[model samples]
Target: MSVSNTTDFTNPSTFILLGIPGLETAHVWLSIPFCTMYIIAILGNITILFIVKRERSLHEPMYYFLCMLAITDVVLSTSTLPKTLSIFWFNSRGINFNACLTQMFFIHCFLAVESGIFVAMAFDRYVAICNPLRHSTILTSHVVASIGLAVLLRGCILLLPHPFLARQLPYCRTNVIPLLYCEFIAVVKLSCGDIRISSYYGLFVSLLKNCLDLFFITMSYTQILRAIFRLPTKDARLKTFGTCTSHLCVILVFYIPALFSALAQRFGQNIPFHFHILFANMCLLVPPTLNPIIYGVKTKPIRDRMLWLFTHKRT
Candidate 1:
């Protein structure tokens, strides 16, 4: 049965977000942890950014990539959390149409940019490990600047259509989105018009950004591993492997939850809706919170700089 296009021609100017259904009673309690995680994510990424910017010794290709990741994390987290916490704490779920579209656009754009950063970082690692002699030559400041521009442009241009597509649709269904934030698919699903185009575009972008990016990252790591194994001494291999441990942890933390949530949404029919919702939220939240810590612990310069900053401030 087709949904009636003429049932309610008057579209709503504002939309409401149904944030974490079945948890209404516990929203206040939920806000506590959500607020804490947001604070930690912002502060952690800021600290990384500040440390990298301040410490001249840390001004290298790796740290520059790390800073890009930090900026994306901060933007991604802030794009969703303020409104998410607002819905939880202040019961402010009403968002105008344009605002919802704007939020969704930035949320997805930063996500794409972040994924691009991961691929760039993977390439950086491959160059540093497999072509040590040419690492500096390959990843000079000009090259890094070019990579940054490419990442930004790829994200902005590719994700540009999503919001415009959503805006063109007639949202005659309920204005209540079923996610914590205004996700592209969720908003598209609310449209009463034919959504085949939007659905296919969403799938195309997902595979393009997520699957292809992950494939290249995995290939990069495979080459890095192959290069490591070719090293003569065990100590050299161990030392080389240690440098990638942080990126590995970050990859696992990011991709696992993201893939899980995506799969669960599509295939897990018996899964609870709340489980899907929370996992989706975690997909956005956990990464930014963990990235800085993983880097700080696994990378020596960042950890030492952080310790030094703390100690130096004591005077």
Candidate 2:
């Protein structure tokens, strides 16, 4: 659907989302898995929140950061999955321009927040393992609150420009976004006007959000590994590293798929459109779906508490 350059055009009042592009026939079937994942993500994160809040023993700094992560996961998945499911089930694909921008804002803002939460989690583990004696003192209630404020502000401030820049463009080309949700890049690329600024800005934000956070998390874990190796005995070293296993697993599941999806969206021109769309949806869904399960299985306290909760409920 290409528009002629000579055609006089105005900003589209509504954009049509072509969910998963080349897979329209399978959309009904695909909705089955997507709906299932959304249910799991919502239930799992909410259960994590409940357990953390109810179990006094899980009220430490690590669990507090986990609560933040779980909350972010809920927002992040919620921002996209419902609309995606709608597109699959009911063919509800038209999104008003303002609503599209709002969705894009929430998606990117919470994504950045999620990245920051991972960094915070890494720091919590570092303090607990590398400087165990002063961990509580370093990460006081006030300090934790400050970190959360900084993270939220950073995401809000940095991503606030995206929609404005997008709005400034003359979207005369086409209003059909070949995505399940209103992705910032996909929406902006529909504009006939110059999009270099938007593209560059998106790249800059991605680097700052993902790369910089990855750097800090890497450094924190590097120090943690060194400290773990310095412990007296094999059992002690394993015990220290055990505390970080859940965080490490969550980070891997969150970052790897996310980075791959971003890169494929930007650079993988030869990739099939439906594959990209499917992978993108998976990238978003997998983290929230897996985070709680990973933590529950890897972290003894959480696992024990979850078991107790279920047992108590059954009784």
Candidate 3:
């Protein structure tokens, strides 16, 4: 609460991100795993995208949604990891204020977009299973394009104010952010003066994006389940339900860690600070890492294509 009175905010405008404090000696060891995970996420998503792009059979609403998800995963992870890797590898922990804001913006924006894509995917599944006859007409190319545009615009518009609001604060306090990246909350916490507006808006935006997205996703899945159960034949039921397994796995990986990370920040004050930081990092990393694996393994078509891609290359 004791902020410095004389430090000029505009003159020396850089924030130092202390990535995993007290683990300085272990940074090299830590970087290995972090670097490995980043590679896997990037390669996996890119592979998914390549397969989705090349295969004509995947030119459907469901696969289109998966493409959106893959793109978001790549951007979200890339936005944070480069700077994070710089910190661990080269000890370049200083980030310019503007650069920090940009990072925070993209990080949250991509996260919002990813969440929106999940909802879109859920709706796609609902239509595909519950109303199979109308599925093609319901989620046509135009509709999919509109959904993609809407998702991007929604994330950008909703998250536009966050960085600017944080920027308006007089940062006379220590410019050190205690996180692995330039997170909105971590940056806001460093600012001087009343930040109630920033904090409240942050909470509101989080609830608005994640909570609403999760709610709609859950509702869509509920209907999907109902529709699947009503099917008379076991084969019909299995085939219909089977299509959703990949998406369901993706939802669990994304939402569970994300919810826990959010809760850890909001209410886990009694918990260890390091635990919260690690959880937040995991929230960002785990989904990107696991999503491709989940889809590739559970979705038979994708798995077959991936295998063919490798085998044909070897031949």
Candidate 4:
């Protein structure tokens, strides 16, 4: 590995992220694929947001959450990529504590909101499955609004105190972040003082929310499965399972990487930094970026409607 000896890594005031290791030599070539993914991620998510908001036909709980998820995806990707592009191409990796804290805040907020939305989506599926007759009534406007507010409130409240723990700590040395974004934990790990308080606060919030969310999600699936098993017809069972198939797969994809990353980070596992970056990207990339694709492919009716709307609007 050729070290850029000219570029100082020990700069205390401004941090320099290597962006992608060994990519500085081929900056243009290295950026193409990442830029493409960013573009596609941006476009796909924005399109979903546009479709959800614009089309009067898609005014439902599923689409509502889908739109929220799209918003999260765009925010998540935006939080990382601009800095990445700047660092990789322009070598401008300087980020102050307040700026870093602000980025970290939104990232955590959106992440919490994303998790809540997914759990709500799971509950929505369970409701639709278990109580088909009253699905509409159960998921009324008031209920949906309450759920949205809950997601937002939970996101903001938990993460609101984090910036205090971060901004107060003196980053006396290199502010270099290993991963792409100014992630709260990763950035806080670089603080000069003892981080026990920050860790405890973060961990308390994490373990509490994660365990509860997982428990409820498990209960929901278990109940849904039990309800499915009682079905008299094979077609009914198949349909019941099919409805949640995409959500299940996506939830697994989203949660597993996150769980692994959390464990690896907390346990101080000897995971390679690059692998850490990869998984970090995967966690953010897969759910927000691939969710629309999953929904589009799994729900043929939605795909048809989307294309029909596009075609009609074009002509």
Residue lDDT tens for model 2, 1-315 = 342334445788888888886688999999999889889999999999999999988878999999989999999999999999988888898888999999999999998999999999999999998788999899998899899889999999999999999999997767888888988988898888899999999999989998899999999999998998899999999988888888999999999998888789779999998999899889888999999999989999989998998899999
For model 4, what is the C-alpha lDDT against the true structure? 0.77
Stretches of candidate 2 above 4 Å error?
Answer: 1-8
Per-residue alpha-carbon lDDT of candidate 1 for residues 1-315, written as tens digits (9 for 90 to 100):
222324454356777887888988898998888889999999999999999999999888999999999999999999999999998988887888899999999999999999999999999999999998999999998999899889999999999999999988987757878788999999988888999999999889989999899999999999999999999999999999999999989989988988888789889999999889988988899899999999999999999999999999997
Ten residues in sequence with the least summed lDDT for candidate 1: 1-10
Which residue pairs in model 3 clash with each other? none
**Residue range 1-315, candidate 4, lDDT tens digits:** 222324433224444455555445765675676677788778887777777777677888878878777888889878877877776687675676567778888888888888888899989989998898998999997899899899989999999988888877766544667656677777777766788889899989888677888888899999999999999999989987988887887788778989888777668577666666767766776676677777777766567777987799999
What's the TM-score of every candidate structure? Answer: 0.96, 0.96, 0.95, 0.88
lDDT of each: 0.90, 0.90, 0.88, 0.77
Task: Write candidate 3's Cα lDDT for 1-315 as tens digits.
Answer: 222335556523788888887788888888888889999999999999999999999999999989899899999999988888888898888888899999999999999999999999999998888888999998999999999999999999999998899888878767888898888888888777788999999999999998899899989998998998999999999998899999999999999888777777788889888778778888898899999999999999899999999999999
- Candidate 1's TM-score: 0.96
**Which 10 consecutive positions of candidate 4 have the poorest summed lDDT?**
2-11
Order of the predicted models by TM-score, top scorer first:
1, 2, 3, 4
Q: Is candidate 2 or candidate 3 better by lDDT?
A: 2
Relative to the true structure, candidate 2 reaches a TM of: 0.96
Give per-residue lDDT, candidate 1, residue 167: 88
- Model 2 gets an lDDT of 0.90
Per-candidate total of colliding backbone pairs: 0, 0, 0, 0
Candidate 3 structure lDDT: 0.88
